[model samples]
Target: MAGVRISRAAGALLGAAGMVVPLAVVTAAPAQAASCTTSTGPYQTRVERFLGRPVDGKQSAADCKATQKFQAQHGITPTIGYAGELTWRTMNTMLAQRAAGKTPNAAGKCPTNKGRIACVDLTRQLSWIQDGKKLTYGPVPVRTGRDGAETRTGLKKVYWRDIDHVSSLYNVSMPYSQFFDGGQAFHSVTKSMWNPPGSAGCVNMRVADAKAYWSLLRNGDDVFVYGRKPGT
Candidate 1:
């Protein structure tokens, strides 16, 4: 019979049961091939557990501190609360790289060799646009959300274009929408600039940035948004 697969948080319950019942510990899955220099920590451990790794005999306080430090050093502040969407997105990328068997250099940082993708650094609250070898867009500061209106973090393909911007539901036409989600979009906001932790979930940009961003794409452009930061 196969042993029950248990999550790290569930292991305690299973361990207690082992005292009264015959419970053979399940072996850990092989560590995914990773060349990252930073050691693992509580948050990473949680991520690993989420990825189906065992926490049985692996706990690293130093690694946790190091990981937290690494994040701070890289521009993400240490938030003691639950892992935010941005952190989770970064973690997912790190996990993917590790699973790919890539090795890190002596400095312990993940290679900056990830070609052309949007990576938002939450601490700096900036969006970096890359295309293969060049960083194309910005560290341009913009608003995100604070009232529980989180920016979506995932891959979304551009479907259509709404040049006259407004809540089409409201019959107000103003700017543009590449139309990633129903109403959520990237558009120009003449009202607010340099204000972060704002926006009702739409990525608001200045007219110039908005226009530039709009011009950079067409129908079917793949856009990956991560971190709840504003963008152009």
Candidate 2:
């Protein structure tokens, strides 16, 4: 990753520059050897799926070249990394569009599979293993970035796991169970302020509800977080 001080996502979004979605035209020649698809990269394929297409899976030279061209046209620095920060920003912007009663740039919101992971707009949070057929916005109190630590909005995966209370890269701790990354988790936090959009990047929840969320999680549980600010 570039050591250059990349701006924290939240700040970038709140600024007047606003969020930029990928609306550029693809100009890479089909015959070019470059390829920068997500299929072979570490990023979740769901991102491409969310965008309503299948990535070539290999980051060919053509892919990189194409991406650079796309970035140059969009005025974004073309970096080669699956699910890069810009990708997250674009995804969030698209989600915001959807929340504003617009369909996502992609064809679907999320796949509806039984007991699968998903997000609930009514509750403004994500859920797991609840007969994914219906939306379950369990009243969990997750702390979101109030000062604009704005959580990346899009499809993500609980790729790793841990037992007992864990902490995030940000050093915030969650008591009594499961994985930690980026100072966030599907763990317990006080719920006195239910669904008020008051978290510092971690998903806050009532202790009891946290337990339910824990039980609901399994490695590879798909997670999606997106919605308008409460009462927008």
List the lowest-lDDT window of 10 residues for candidate 2.
Answer: 18-27
List per-candidate RMSD values in Å: 20.6, 18.2
lDDT of each prediction vs. the true structure?
Answer: 0.44, 0.43
Model 1: how far residue 153 lies from native, Å: 0.8
| Candidate 1 local lDDT, 164-184, one digit each (tens) | 644423343436554444334
Identify the candidate with maximal TM-score: 1
Measured against the true structure, the TM-scores of the candidates, in listed sequence, are: 0.44, 0.42
Candidate 2 TM-score to native: 0.42
* Model 2 deviation from native, Cα RMSD in Å: 18.2
Q: Write the per-residue lDDT of candidate 2 for residues 45-159, one digit (tens) a residue.
A: 5344444444755554444444445333333433443445455444454454446332221333555653566453322333333334553544233444333544456666664
Provide the lDDT at 232 for model 2: 28
Prediction-by-prediction clash tally:
5, 23
